[model samples]
Structure formats: C-alpha cells, structure tokens
Target: MTRGPGRWAVLSAFTVLAVVMLLPFVIVALNAVKSPAEYSSGGPLSLPHGLYLDGIVQFWQRVNFGQKLLNSLMISAAVAVLATLLSVLNAYALGIGRVRGRLWILVLFLLANTLPQEALVYPLYYIAKQVGLYDSRLAVVIIFTVIQAAFGTYLLSAVLGDFPKAIMEAAAIDGASRWRILWRVVVPISRPTLTVLMIFFFIWTWNEFFLPLVFLISNDTQTVPVALGVLQGDKMMDATMSSASSLLGIIPAVAFFLIFQRTLTRGVTVGAVK
Candidate 1:
C-alpha cells in the first residue's frame, strides 16, 4: 500500500535527523565515562576501555550542579510563564480585535527580531545596570522574556489567526469579557501551542550564555552555560571534563523535549494548519 512506503520514508528521515542531531551527545556520553588519557587518546568516535565517573563527579563538585540547576529552573520557569502569557495576550488582542495600528505593532516586533541580539546587548546591559538589577536572576528572567517575546508573539499570533472566529463570536454572545474568553476558551483550545512555547522558552532561557556571561559576575549566580564555561577553561579543555559538563548541561532540555515531544509535534502541525 502507499501507506507502507510513506511510513518507511518518514521513519527513515527521522532516523537520519536524529542521528545527525545526537552526534554531539554521543561524543559527550562516551567521553563523559572515559579517563582523561583515554578521552584524549581515543578519538571522539572511539570506544573507551572502561567507564569512569571522575569527570562527571568532579564537574558536579566544582560547579555545584544542584544549586545551578535550581537557579536555571527558577529563571527558565519564570521566563516561560511570562513569555507565554504576554504572547497569548498579544496574539489574542491582535487576532480578535480591530486595532487600527496592529500592522505597525507587528512590523515593529518583526524588525526587532531581525536585529541581531549582539547589536542591542550593550544598551540592554546599561539599562539593566541603571535599574539596579545587574547580576540578578530577576534581571535574567526579564531579559529572557523581552528578548523572546517578539518571536513568541509572532508564532502565537499566526496560530491565533487560524483559530475559528465562530468561537469568539459565540463567547461574545454569551457575555464573556475578553479576559474570561482568553482564560476560559482561547488558552484551553490552544494548549498545544502554549506547550511548545513554554518548552522553547525553557530551552532558550536555560541555555542562554552570552547575556549571562556579560552581565553576571558572581559565581553563585552563574547559569549552567556560564558554569560550564568556567569548568571548561579550568580544565584547559580536558576532553573528558568538557564532554561531561556538556552532557550534564544538555540533559535537562533533552529530557524535557522527550517528555513532551508529542505535544511539541502536535503544536507545530496544528499551528501550521491554516
């Protein structure tokens, strides 16, 4: 049947893509468990003589992985929530209402997105310092929310554009306020998009390095990426330790995706269905 070939093609494509994406992780895993000499002498693709946890153990001890993870989680979670809410609100306002200046607003967001993040870093850093929030977790969260909001808003607006207008009219007929409609109707119906947004926001905030690298000076406030950088430098690029830290830094995002992959896929397809 046609279905058989189509299924095989899809599976084959996914397998190829997965292998491509996971190559670095594969290297990290093997190197994570390799002795330092074995790590350097063994090529990235080579097998190790025996499993060793020294690199991982040392990284944990040096970085205080638990505390860093907690900080990352708090910052990431806060950013996700704020970004999602702001995105949803913006999308609903633009999608459901007749705002005269909607096009200009959307254009401004798109223009900002086109500008490289590096271009604005200096100004944003100065502003953060002026606000007395430099080096704080709250500062990171706020920056993450603002920097990510444009793309999130654009994506959510596209999804909302495809949402059925009949539902909005019916809710209005039932005398529902915009807030009630957003909370009771739109959000529940757009659950998939929201999940995808949250996952992406979490990933972005968790892995953010450059902003944190520039702004945060205190070791205690360093996120995983910053911590990993310090570790990598301390080890003078010791392959085992570098690889172990890389693996540790990546696990949370990978696990999060694996846990919610179905929702992520559904979100992409559903949001794209115009």
Candidate 2:
C-alpha cells in the first residue's frame, strides 16, 4: 500500500481490472446502435456499421422504460435513506447509549445481515400477501430497509463506539440533551461514513434482482433489473435490441456512481491539507 516498487504492480493490476470491468460496457455501447443485420453478421465484438436508432427506440418504448427508471430510483432512494436512518438510530442506542447487553444486540443485527434473502422470501411473500402489500413497491421498500439497515447498524455501531467521549462530555456540559447532541454533534461528525453507507445502499438496492423479480411480478411495479430480464425474455427482441436494453439498464447506475464518486473522494481528502 505504501509507495514502493510494489506500487507499480498494484497499479498494473488495477489497470487490468479496470479494463476487464469496462470491456462489457464498451461492447454494449457499440452494439446498442448496431443494426440487427450487422450484429448478426459481425456479433457484439464488432464495430457498428451505422448508427441504428430503431432498436434502441423500440426497446425503450416496449419496456416503458421511463416507468422502470422511476420505480428503481424511488425504491433505491427510499431504501438508502430509510436504511441509513434506521442504522443510525440502532447504532446510536447500542454504541453511544451503551444499552445493557448491547453486544448481543449487535450480534443480532450481524446475523440478520448475514441471513440470506432466500430464507426470507417465503415469509416475506406470505406476510405481504396477507397484509395486501404483495406486488407493491412499498413492500419491497420495507423489506430492503430492514435488510440493509441490519448491516449498517453493525458497521456504524463500531464506528461510534470509538467516537471521542471528550467531545460528547463537552456537549453534555453545554446543556445539550442526547437527542440534540445526536443530530447536532454525532451525525455531523459521522456524515462521511453515513454518506458512504448511503451510496452503497442505493446502488445495492438498485441492482437487486431476485427479490424484486419474485415480489414485483407486475409490469407496473418492476425496476430496471426486472425490466432488463423482461426485455431479454421477450420473443420479439433482437440481438441489437438486447444490447440496447443492457446499455439502457446500465446508464443510470453508472451515472449515480460517477456523481457520488466525487463525494467519496472529497470525504477521504478533507483533512489532507490541514
């Protein structure tokens, strides 16, 4: 990790890894605009003969892509926010408050996080059906909020456990209640970590497939991943159109990551010049 001859090896490794990750995107982008005839003849690795818009346009319209975008954005944003808040609250109680048997409580959250979604599918489906939330985005939102929050609590609790007791004592002496101190002091100090958590939660929820597939069977409630699956399975789809679908599916998540990427770097570099 330190600067040395080893750094060159690390850089070379990352360069190769980056190329591998980016290769699919490049292929998809090129093929998204390739005519079916060209794609059939030359395949995905080939350069496009011309700019073909029809397949991309048709795929977009066929999938009702705008709705899928909205659903994915809404669900991911909701889960990210709700999960972060829940994690903060749980962490605050366990770490800062030091509630009795807090070790067991943290363990409980860790186990909840480690538990596979497969194990909960049937119960979630049944409960949602019983409560009339099945096939609803709200149900998915609720499920992921709890699921993501469990890990967040596990992580943030440890971070807060190392928080400066001196600062907390100073705040208390200045007449700050625990509630006020949490929002005004604790949350502010923890913003970078919380932001990182939010970014991961948003992206993770955005890319979720299986649970979304199982629960969001209705076209009206489906997210981008679900829509991509639907697009792939459609009998009328062509190779070029499938590529266009993949390209479309990738753009939003990539855009989100790139935009927040600045925030991530900023968080890490904030104190470097100080």
Which has the greatest lDDT?
Answer: 2
State the lDDT at 186 in candidate 1. Answer: 89
Tell me each candidate's RMSD, in Å, in order: 2.5, 2.5
lDDT of 2 by residue, 1-274 (tens): 4688788889999999999999989999999999989988997799887899998899889889999999999999999999999999999999999999999998898889878889999999999999999999999999999999999999989989988999999999999999998999999988888898899999999999999999999989999999998667778898889988999999999899899998877766642332
lDDT of 1 by residue, 1-274 (tens): 3569889999999999999998878888998899988766867778989899988898888779988888888888999999988888888887666477877888888897898879978998999889999989888888889878888887777678768889988999999988998899989999987988898998888888888888777878888888887666573557888888888988988898798899889989976783
Q: lDDT scores for all predictions?
A: 0.84, 0.92
| Backbone N/Cα/C clashes per model | 0, 0
Off by over 4 Å in 1: 2-17, 40-43, 235-237, 272-274
Return the TM-score for candidate 2, rounded to 2 decimals. Answer: 0.94
